[model samples]
Target: MAKGERPKDSRRLSRKKTKQKIFFDEVCRMTKLVPKNKLTTYGAIARAMGVDNYSRHVGFALGKVKASDGVPWWRVINSSGRISFRPKDRVGEGTRAKPFTSLQSIKLAGEGHTFTEAGAIVGWTKKLHDFNR
Candidate 1:
């Protein structure tokens, strides 16, 4: 499919599912470009895909990626440069459970991304990968 064009199956599926797949695919592709130790926000990925208001959709897409997908899902974060996943215990009923935030933080730290004492990414604006530029 052409970039920015919806998939052929879009017409047959529910609107939400179709958009989710498109946003998911775009996020997966763009995430592969983020270099180690650098990061981008869910909002940044959404903007890159030309969906400025779909930042949460970017998060949804990342949640669906499997380890075998090789999408570097860990490189994406919330706009505040914080890990977006809540602890499993804090998740409400019917919500998707997430792996521990500490695990995500550890992985980012291993890649050389620094964090503040309170756990937000340190100097996040400076560390963001500006794909648009």
Candidate 2:
């Protein structure tokens, strides 16, 4: 955090790890809603756990869980609340990018989350209080 020190990447990496650890338990609790109800998004988990700016960090934690831990990692999505698949491109074609949005979407869908036509959640955080409340 020094002057003219472009340590943004390092700072982000460290914060990502720390946020992942802090939000891990909350993410697990949210994922437990799956197989009975629908999937919960990373944003939901982060908000529930009081993490204002580390929503995607929750996704990283879930990915780590999928790789090694046994946490229920298939219950997260984007802010839009949709489960969109990664755009597929045939051989010798362009657009082979695999955005994490699709992965988050697929995992949430696997847990039975219902999406609207525009991909928003059916009934997301309706009862939650607003900032002024």
Model 2: residue 31 alpha-carbon error in angstroms: 2.5
Taking the tens digit of each residue's C-alpha lDDT, what string does model 2 give over 4-108? 887759888998878657667667766655443445566667776777677777776666564345555544556665542323311233354732345444544
**Cα-based lDDT for every prediction:** 0.79, 0.56
Q: What's each prediction's TM-score? A: 0.74, 0.46
Assess the local accuracy of residue 9 in candidate 2 as a C-alpha lDDT between 0 and 100.
93
- Top candidate by TM-score: 1
Off by over 4 Å in 2: 1-20, 33-35, 84-133
Q: For model 2, what is the error of residue 24's alpha carbon versus the real structure, in angstroms, after optimal superposition? A: 2.5
TM-score of 1: 0.74
TM-score, model 2 to reference:
0.46
